[model samples]
Target: MTVKNATAVRLAEILQTKRLENPIGNALLESAARGDLRMDALQRLVGTEAQAHRAELAAYGTMLARYPEHPAADLFIQLAQLVYAAQPKLRECAKALGMSDAHSSRWPAERATYSFNGTLSWLAVQGSQAACALASYTDMKVYFSGCTQFAQRVRTDGIDVPPEFLAYYDDEGSEELRQLALDVVQNGLDRGDDEADAVFCARLLEESIGEFWQSAAGTI
Candidate 1:
């Protein structure tokens, strides 16, 4: 289905809203938040793979050294901070949902280390952001799919999750969110920014996945 412009913007807002209420979703959103900035930065530079790789590697090295303890978690947290700082509206929405900024910091740490390959594979096929903007339009599709599944589960099980809380994964009337994501992807692609942003976002995502591996290994 073709997404409308107004709906596209609304989807972005809904995605933002979902992130605020769901810790797991927030962690994924944090990666996209950081990836967005990295994409913006990379777009301004001119270089082939070798040159860009050297620069990005150096930056990653610095990041690794500076955040020796839970580097990936730290990076995600930082990204969350940036999003919270820049998007007060999101903060307010989250607050109304009874979640706090502290949840963002603790959530990533609570999960067991996940496989980089597995997470990337899932994210590549599912989830949102510049990385999976086009391809199969899988980013938002995966999310909506998940939301639908969760809703079904709730209906069948009659779980006790609050209605407001359900907003995190609700897409009952979210045609707008889906449309917004498509618009963002199309706009990014049309401007050639999509390719660059996708690449950068992918790298950042890979790094986080690697960090998860490291975190798991360290515990072992």
Candidate 2:
């Protein structure tokens, strides 16, 4: 059954009114029953999503603060800021590299905001950012080496980015990696129940991102 998009509370009320059989909805109700629902993410999930840049930056900060030594911790911190930069430049780079227009459409400019509580939404909006973010966390020496190279590129290439971030745009095999990253992100988001526990999404985020870092390392 397609879950019509709604905030957690609204989704719960609708599920109750319709007596729907959604596991997520049921979980939300259970959380509410236990008075442990994370109403912040749910309430902040809609209308307020335009805060994508702020929200993602804050998320990275929260995660880094929460888990600073987790191999990919610095990667996450850098990638969040990278997403903001890559969000604007992704499509143009995709076009320049002669990638399929179908993929190019996915990286459109106006669609570069975060999608809250929706796996599909996150998949769509942050797809390109996801690709680049994953690339930065590769444990492989070569891929990990690219992180420094990207920083160099950021400095020499000088595309209006800050002086500190080591953001990179790898036209080489980026499309495939991006698609893979998006798929992994989709999997994590799909498994997580945001309506129930807001922290679960964040947790799945760390796990999914950590998975990419490990995969990048293994592929070396």
Candidate 3:
């Protein structure tokens, strides 16, 4: 069955709240936060060097293109829909926080970037492709851990990031989120659908990654 907008939002909210409470969740969230902070700082320093970052995103996108129906892909698609549905409220949140979409022009781009990274990591672990798996896992570990640092930067630098914007990286109380993610992954594994799932997730990642890069370049 296709994932509905309401179901997606509920899943996201549940995952976030549940996942944040676990140690693994904390580690992953913190890592991602750090990466985000670094990206933000890099953007500030280099101004719009979108080309430099394109290669990394491209590599990631390619990896994700391998798994369209993966649990990660399902999660991302849900996230994209939820974010789109919440645009009105999200915009309001951005306005209240005095944040501009200048850094991340569209919600889809933000969702793609965040979800792609996680999916890449998950695929690496599940896929038997030695080289890609190693690289993706390494990148995933670093990205998740970096999230904490990014959150810190937002607080310290007085970055006007809205809560909704932060929600993508918010692992503050996400035990349920972790459980949901785990359930998806385990189910795929148990059903021996891991390979198929990876391919599905990969395809979604590839498309969204390209879209994100295009949006960033166009913005520049």
Please name the candidate that would achieve the greatest lDDT relative to the true structure.
3
Full-model lDDT for every candidate? 0.37, 0.34, 0.39
True-vs-predicted CA distance for residue 127, candidate 2, Å: 21
**TM-score top scorer:** 3
Give lDDT tens digits, candidate 3, residues 1-220: 7543333234334433433563222222333445443334323211122221323444445434654556555543443343354455444444544545323553323443344445445554455332242223223333334444556656776766657556644334334433434445444444554444343443433433333333222321
TM-score of each: 0.33, 0.25, 0.34
lDDT of 1 by residue, 1-220 (tens): 7545443344344544544573233232333334332221111111111122222333434433433344232432343343344334333434544545422333223233333324344544443333443321333344345445545555565555545435534554345434433555545444444354454444444444334423322321
Write out the backbone clash pairs for model 1.
8-180, 11-177, 127-139
Evaluate model 2: give its lDDT: 0.34
- Please give, for residues 1-220, the per-residue lDDT of candidate 2 as tens digits: 7432223324224323432342212222233335554433222211122233344555555544544543335455555666466544433433343433322232212221222213322432343332223322221222233344433443453434422122223323244433333333333334443333332333333333332222222211
Clashes of 3: 49
Arrange candidates by lDDT, descending: 3, 1, 2
Model 3: which ten-residue window has the lowest total lDDT?
43-52
RMSD of 1: 16.4
Q: Which stretches of candidate 1 lie over 4 Å from their true place?
A: 1-104, 108-132, 135-137, 191-220
